[model samples]
Target: MAIRLDFQTEKKQGSLLITEESESNKTDVIRGFFSLFGFEKEPMQTTVYSPEIVVHSQGKAEEIQKQVSEAINQRLQQLESRPSKDEVEIKKPELINSKRTLNPTIGEMIGGAPQQEAPPEEPEWYQTGIKNKEGVPHYKLRYWCKNPQCRDRSNDYIKEDQKTVKCRKCGQKLLVRQAADEHMKRDEWGNFFIADKLAP
Candidate 1:
């Protein structure tokens, strides 16, 4: 059986017509050809006309129609070269064990398995709380000499109040009252510790 196909190209659109033939099944062949070249197939029939399949093409009609015609000719040649169903032999595929195959279960294939999560990070020692020599949590109090010209204005951590507080650099006397005014304050992260209040 032979199949007859016709096509026309216009300015903005292109169309293909498959003439009806009772000897062969042209619908499948036309559909496959249209799909291979990205064309849309539409069914059309009228009382006065024979049944036919129509496919519309987009883009440059001349170029698209030429390509579609070439593809259809090639497909028809291939179909002609293929052996008839009665002259061909069929073989069943060999079966393998489920374990040997890498096919995972539906649950695993769809990402249903729980993955190992990373451990939660621990806060740094300084951030948790300031510790004394005995490993007990304590507030850190800092003081500095008030004499501006003494060059001993650097801060010193005073853990306890003593009768005499003096700057180690210049032997200048430091008052506990002034130390209270220069106490270091820290934020939740403990990154910034400054006098009076936490750094902005």
Candidate 2:
């Protein structure tokens, strides 16, 4: 008996040819191979086939041939059940909009363009006209939240003795500095002028 395996793919196609010398010889070889691979309980008694066994053999070779044919047919059915290259549909990948932002917006869901947000205002100093015992002027700082995710921006009234201040909403540290009134010349109302400097 002869067996042939034909396989085809999208890029390549091939055929495999398998032949047996004789029915009895092929049966012995198949039994030996299966036993060698632990597929059978009995091991091959002799590596070489004897004339006596061949002459004495009645219907054993035919039985083994039938089993081998059934196994090959079952395997071919399994291969045929799989999706073939020609039967399978190839889909093109979806095009991603790189310009689109990761943050989902109401406008995006409604099929409208999203509105751009105004840039945050930078921190600025404001004098409160309050002075400590040492005559150092106190100032309030209006700053934006340092946290990228936080939008809470407000003024924090820092005490004269307080060295550090943080955002009340996000707990992010605020950069604060005392007004150097002693080092600057002030007008009659006691407001320090940035352009005027005191004598060394």
Candidate 3:
């Protein structure tokens, strides 16, 4: 039986339509062709607007049509060459009865039994210091007022020189120091002065 194939090659609205003399009987074959060519399984009904196949480009439409024609020709040739149903003998598939054995799991292969977990080690001295929730250590230097009367103390993260800090009681500018032992020379006026140390 002859098959009629229609195609629309418009840039925006392109489609290919396939119609056979016995399309109702050859539904499976048509579905297979659509699947083989990566087309939608649902067939578009013949109408004033809709076409059989909708392609993205003109080249694709033409290529699909050519392929479909070739496939149909091949199918027809195969059908013609095949023996009649009465003359052909069908063999039933033989059933094999076998037990499916699963391979040994990783634990089974290693020791066969679950081992007890060891206790976690204690944290080191440095690790146990002042740290954030994420276990990151924060080292803050101590900053205190030099005035004995106003023995106010504060903690800061930065280590810059001459960092001015206001005392709560005296409200005087207190210079920051890395260590308590940092020497400060006293002038004749009794004012303490820090000598500038040159880089060696």
Top candidate by lDDT: 2
The deviation in Å at residue 184 for candidate 3 is 99
* Candidate number with greatest TM-score: 2
Better of 2 and 3 by lDDT: 2
TM-score of 1: 0.22
lDDT of each: 0.45, 0.48, 0.45
lDDT of candidate 2 at residue 52, scale 0 to 100 = 17
> lDDT tens string, model 3, 25-141?
445554544444455544433212222322232233234344445665676787799999998999977567444558766778998868778988764522322324345433334
Show pairs that collide, candidate 1: none
lDDT of 3: 0.45
- Residue pairs with colliding backbones in model 2 are none
Per residue, candidate 1 scores C-alpha lDDT tens digits across 15-56 of 344554531344465555555455555432111111232334
Off by over 4 Å in 1: 1-131, 134-139, 160-164, 178-200
Q: Tell me the TM-score of model 3.
A: 0.20
For candidate 2, write residues 57-77 as lDDT tens digits.
123334544554666666667
Ranking by TM-score: 2, 1, 3
- Lowest-sum lDDT 10-residue window in model 2: 48-57
Backbone clash count for every predicted candidate, in the order shown? 0, 0, 2
Candidate 3: clashing pairs of residues: 15-53, 16-53
TM-score of each: 0.22, 0.27, 0.20
RMSD of 1: 17.1
Model 2 error, position 124 (Å): 6.1
